[model samples]
Target: MTSRTFAAFLQRSLEELKEQGLYNTIEPLEGPNGPTIAIRGRELVNLSSNNYLGLATDERLVEAAVRAARTWGAGSGAVRTINGTLRLHEELEEKLAAFKGTEAAVSFPSGFACNMAAISAVMGPGDAILSDELNHASIIDGIRLTKSTTIRYRHSDMDDLRAKAREARDSGKYEKIMVVTDGVFSMDGDVAKLPDIVDIADAHDLIVYVDDAHGSGVLGGGAGTAKHFGLSDKIDLQIGTLSKAVGVVGGYVAGSRELVDWLKARSRPFLFSTALPPAAVGASIAAIELLQESRELQERLWRNAAYLQQGLRELGFSVGATETPITPCMIGNEETTQLFSRRLYEEGVYAKAIVFPTVPRGTGRVRNMPSAAHTTELLDAALAAYAKVGRELRLIP
Candidate 1:
């Protein structure tokens, strides 16, 4: 039998969340997660995926995955430190390093795992981390794992970062100091002030770590935020995810050869967890090659993004400070935001409402991710839905 105390605590916590409209209801997709998705047997314009380049459903990637599975079997069969380091894995890493303009790279099972492994591997009790306040949850958790003294500067506020960095450096209390941030703030879609950040890091002699999970495949002709800012050599560590724009599963850290070697030696996830599957590795390699060969997909992605963002703005919906494809129609009240999302779904759009603690309270929104796969017609349909719902709810005049 279960413990009554534990069950009671779970019940109370769930009840409180539901009461506050903070509880999220999961809806399973009936088919492939493409530009359009089917939920509850209804087709809707999909605006909740991170498949920025539509490569997740690309034929070239699918064929590559099939070939890989045929040749390498299903799984890697062990942790990377063991016999799991397949030739295919090495090829993927090589392509990633080349694409990111780095000397070498190390792969992890997921982006979250990459941060967890990399951060804790290099930082410890005597070390300090200066982090952006609005950094992703994975970054926040990774810092916590290190037991390092974490100093949160204002989000993208270089003055605050410089002040904190100088104080941390002058304090002489920590052994190694590192500054970490997201290349693209996923929630707000604003690119990081990387050029300024590199300048500050240069002044303080701090190790610079950037998790360009969203920025990769979308920025710098698909080279990522560091390359977008022409600071690939200046930034110390760069992290990326294959699942987002690459349309596959896994994460990687690219930097100097020494950093890659160090992560391979010390990262716990690499040492403990089983390796990514052959199919995923194969598909990711194809995706990277595709990105390297042409800028057609990136161009399409940006065009669709601009078109949708402009449509929302013309409809008078506030898409807060986004400089990228992630468009959020800001709706302040939690319940109202949820209702708006539901209304959109009813009108055949599948954008989801993001509330705390994904974002701050009273800053709830219906976050829309426009992909290259979405045609102009699909986007227009989504905008029409937005118009009807916004007017019905009196959200727009």
Candidate 2:
């Protein structure tokens, strides 16, 4: 395409998004992303962060990062295949494996990269992937990159998944079949039926892959969704991100030692990308150790979620069906969802609205992420704001 053609296409697409109320205006946080954050110098109750256990601002992790920076310097220096894999990286992987209840684990620069690397490493042209319709974007892109046959089933519909899996297996056109899903749907805050998924996998001899980015530090006493259902060993691939609950940046894939070995030997990201910095590696190690040592933070996170959810429900706002701390206020339609989020901001709440392409159209919502760092008093303030804005907009009684 010509430069002028590309420029006009970009401008037209952005304009279309803006007109449709789908273009998001990202709010910059002026301070640490904690229970309350300073946005544009105004402090607001932060309900948009993914710091489930509130470990992002933990002093222990900070100190660990500092010590690591002082001892190991700023970066890992080269790609993992070219001497970038440090003792720090190995230690982090080992700790991650123990935390996830897997035999071995491999790390990547980001959670998104982990999906791409993990999927492509094991799947190819003749293979097929039975994906949940609501799987993350990275997973979809990973499947596309593999040039494999992709079959999408309804979100968490066990019957649909079972039919699709059986059909794919019986087709005999594919060498291998994989059933992949998100342990916790980020937008809906609902968990996948892992028990049902596993049964289907076993019936068809399909490989199971679960991307538990939002579940790793929030479910199963902080062990994750698979363990929440006691199917950790039955799962073939368990993917996670250190950036969210772990309060650092990076991603990982955990499973049998052979799986990890294959990833180390064949995954492109592991071979081509630079390793995580010493600070991130150290902080992640600290985060996992903290999760293993105590359940205090996870408990607080649930309490906060329940409190906020009850408040929303009492105010007649629909919080989605979520077993985890991710509380979403369902306000149908793009315009209202966007307006509601703006009002929430004006009322000193930091909940962000999620709309189409992220979730199905007309099911837009203001997704709230409660954390352990939030106090009752702060949560009360947020609830008050939600009530006020909801009533003013006739979103609730």
Candidate 3:
């Protein structure tokens, strides 16, 4: 097609998205993504950010970043293979290894890249990956990129997983078998049954990979889902993001020392991509240190989450099967979910809608992330807004 025709097609697609209320319009956060943010000249309660531990705006973290930047300069200058491997990077890796209770750890530029690089590097061609159906998009993409035989089981369904594991092991069509799942399902706020998954992996002799992007710093009093279930020693690969609870920009894989060395020698993202900046590395190290020092933040986070979940439930809104700090209020249709988010925004709350492609079509929801930084007064205000919107939309009677 010519440029004009392609342009017309793009416009039509965007128009269709707008008509369906699925069009995403970016709203610039005037300041840091904290308990509240200024958007469109209004201060709205922020319930959409992944800054679970509220360390993004932490004074200590900022100081650490400044200190590192002053000492190490701005950028790392190249990939890890070249000059990017700074002292801060090594320190961060050591800190992450200790945090996750692993022999060693390897850091990557982002969690998504870590998934893409690690999955593809370790398993390829004739290998089979038994993945959870509700795994994160990054995991799905990584599995696809590997060109491996992918078998998807029902979300957190051990029975289905066992069935698939049996089939994969008995088939004798692949060299290796692996099980992939998110430590926590983001949309539904449910946690992966790590103990069950570990048991299955042991029986099936499958390499286990758990992406604890949403669980790290929130569960196990900060270690993650593996630690929460006391299966840290059993699980083979523990994937995590520094961006969420740690309030930094990067990802990592914590596992056996051999695996870390192997990934350093093999993972394409680590080989080709630029390393994380000194500032981010320093901040992440500080975050991990903070998490280790106290569970006060984690306790407050859960306390806030419980309060929000209870309030939403008492208001007669369905919170689905949330087993973690992530509280998702289900609204059946995509249109309703989007409108619910917009209405919440209008009411000075900033919870975002998760619909259609993010979740299944009928499982659309407005995911509310209650953080430790959120004060009781702020939460009360947000809950009032939710109550008003629920009533207006008839989500609650």
Give the number of the best model, judged by TM-score.
1
**Cα displacement (Å) at residue 71, model 1:** 0.2
Worst 10 residues of 1 by lDDT: 1-10
Candidate 3 residue pairs in clash (backbone atoms < 3 Å): none
Look at candidate 1 and give me any clashing residue pairs: none
Candidate numbers, best TM-score first, in rank order: 1, 3, 2
- TM-score, cand. 3 vs. native: 0.98
Better of 1 and 2 by lDDT: 1
In model 3, what lDDT does residue 247 have?
Answer: 93
Error of 1 at 182 (Å): 0.2
Better of 1 and 2 by TM-score: 1
Q: What stretches of model 1 exceed 4 Å from their correct place?
A: none
lDDT of each: 0.95, 0.93, 0.93
Please, what is the TM-score per model? 0.99, 0.98, 0.98
Per-residue alpha-carbon lDDT of candidate 2 for residues 196-291, written as tens digits (9 for 90 to 100): 999999999999999999999899988899999999999999999999999999999999999999999999988989899999999999999999
Tell me the tens digit of each residue's lDDT in model 3 across 291-323: 999999999999999999999999999899999
Best by lDDT: 1
Candidate 2 Cα outliers beyond 4 Å, as residue runs: none
The true-versus-predicted C-alpha distance at residue 116 of model 3, in Å, is: 0.4
